[model samples]
Target: MDNEFYNAFASPISVTQNALLKNETGTTQKPPKLMDIDDYNGWSERFGNWVEAYHLDAWDHTEVQYFRPLGSDRKPIPIRELSDEEKKKYKNEKLMVSLLQ
Candidate 1:
């Protein structure tokens, strides 16, 4: 894997380790800053490519289901049907960023 990609993937673990070290030293450490969805686009693309390369149709299906959550009644709704603002917010969430990375 690319070093940049590896570093990005390892960042969270590093932060967690730092936090633990600080705690052991009786120091308080602030929480890590979150990344928005735009920050995750590259990672998402990479993951999608990896999945395609592996010939995993399951990953493709999971990706589709991810953007479109099942309704309370278990009905599927297209993610694009969301309002512009909602879409923007979802795209920028940390969960998406982490998963993408």
Candidate 2:
């Protein structure tokens, strides 16, 4: 009875200690803000490639029901090439929507 109570209390304390010391099973933790624009662009490019290869079957922009994405006004917009002004909004971004016909 005493051993069970002791273990129940000690288990949580050990977990808290591990988290505080950042020593949870040899896993490395890094802050999210450490990534810059280049890193984001690179990852986005890679992700876009994967999506193109795997998720290309459903890349229609005409039918909003397929993609189900919304614009600022909560309305579906056709996925056309962004103008210079619109491109400015995503200046640092890379590998945006896959170019489709």
Candidate 3:
């Protein structure tokens, strides 16, 4: 993905830390944990814009099945009610991981 696009999805702080980690360890780590849904929505919006602007092909990778986030009571959060903060955090994390590779 493009740098500008990645930047839009990630927090400035995370980006800086990612650069530092790259310089120090010669390897990067997982993305910081996200806290809410706004983050995820922002990332998805940026990603959508990138795909539209660049006319990129759709992802064709295998889909991994995972459990939905559950609270301490083990009740899954409703999909429509999920938050975006964690998603943004994860997107940054994925970017950091890509930098390492």
Candidate 4:
């Protein structure tokens, strides 16, 4: 994957955290499950730390960026006319969402 292409659409922390992940163990802790309101405080803190470790917290500060292919002229290509490669790129965004969820 092109880090430049990926970072172009990502939050600022995405670049730094991703760089760190690449350099480090590249493993993240799973978030603690929330069973009920009673567990909210502890679960929230642990989950927040887990997401932050993986830079998934970027999603909380940024709106979802839908993939938009660029044409040769450098303008965005219509979503309806995506090539197979573009479709694959679009799926990358979905993968990020799945990670956060």
Best by TM-score: 4
Compare candidates 3 and 4 on TM-score and give the better one. 4
Query: Lowest-lDDT window of 10 residues in candidate 2?
Result: 25-34
Report the number of clashing residue pairs per model.
1, 0, 7, 0
Model 2 segments beyond 4 Å from truth? Answer: 1-38, 59-101
lDDT of 3 by residue, 1-101 (tens): 69888877697888887776554333222222323456666544544444334332221111222335787788977655567854543444454334323
Give all candidates' CA lDDT scores. 0.50, 0.43, 0.46, 0.61
- Local accuracy of candidate 1 as per-residue lDDT tens digits, 10-84: 788898987665533322222122234564555456555554554344344455543545677888656677777
Off by over 4 Å in 4: 1-29, 56-100
Off by over 4 Å in 1: 1-38, 63-101
Model 2, span 31-95: residue lDDT tens: 11213456666545644454445444333222222333467888854446555544433332222
Candidate 4 least-lDDT 10 residues: 22-31
The TM-scores of all predictions, comma-separated, are 0.24, 0.24, 0.23, 0.33
Clashes in model 4: which pairs?
A: none
Candidate 3 Cα outliers beyond 4 Å, as residue runs: 1-81
- RMSD of candidate 3 to the truth, in angstroms, is 16.6
